[model samples]
Target: MNTTNNIVPAQVIALKKQRVILKTETNEVITVNVSKGKKKDKVFMLTMADLLRSGLWIPVNRTLRQLMRYDWLDTPVKSYAF
Candidate 1:
């Protein structure tokens, strides 16, 4: 199954090693894979884990490199560039 697409699914996988199903507005559901350790030069994810350990899951709403920043497990994909 394709584990790429929605950011939420990736984030869920990043936070918890539990794969989840996310329904996109396009009426498509995607499945994600949650792996251990760091991949894709995962600096943010490593930091996120640290935050989680310190009981901090609220930073996900902030922007990257800002005072507080959180992002999906995978780097956000831009346009498909058809």
Candidate 2:
């Protein structure tokens, strides 16, 4: 939410899910991991494109001070009333 910093988070692309393919900003495509996971074994299948577009790509450090700042809110569900 801070526009002062224009850095993207590493977590945006560092999730533990298998990547089907990777597309570079230059329009080059490559076959990458289908999912991202370290030796510990955890996988996430969430789509991160929206986050990337919003420029929230900054990586978050797992510190109590950082996590405690948030009150654990959820995004409102999108709707179509047409």
Candidate with top TM-score is 1
Give the alpha carbon lDDT tens digit for every residue of 1-82 in model 2: 5532322123233323344233334333333343234222322233344433443422232221121112211233354244
List model 1 lDDT by residue over 1-82, tens digit each: 3422213211222344433223334434344333453434467556556644554323221111111223433445572244
Worst 10 residues of 2 by lDDT: 64-73
Q: Give lDDT for model 2.
A: 0.31
True-structure RMSD for candidate 2: 10.2
- Per-residue lDDT for 67 in model 1? 19
State in Å the error of residue 67, model 1.
13
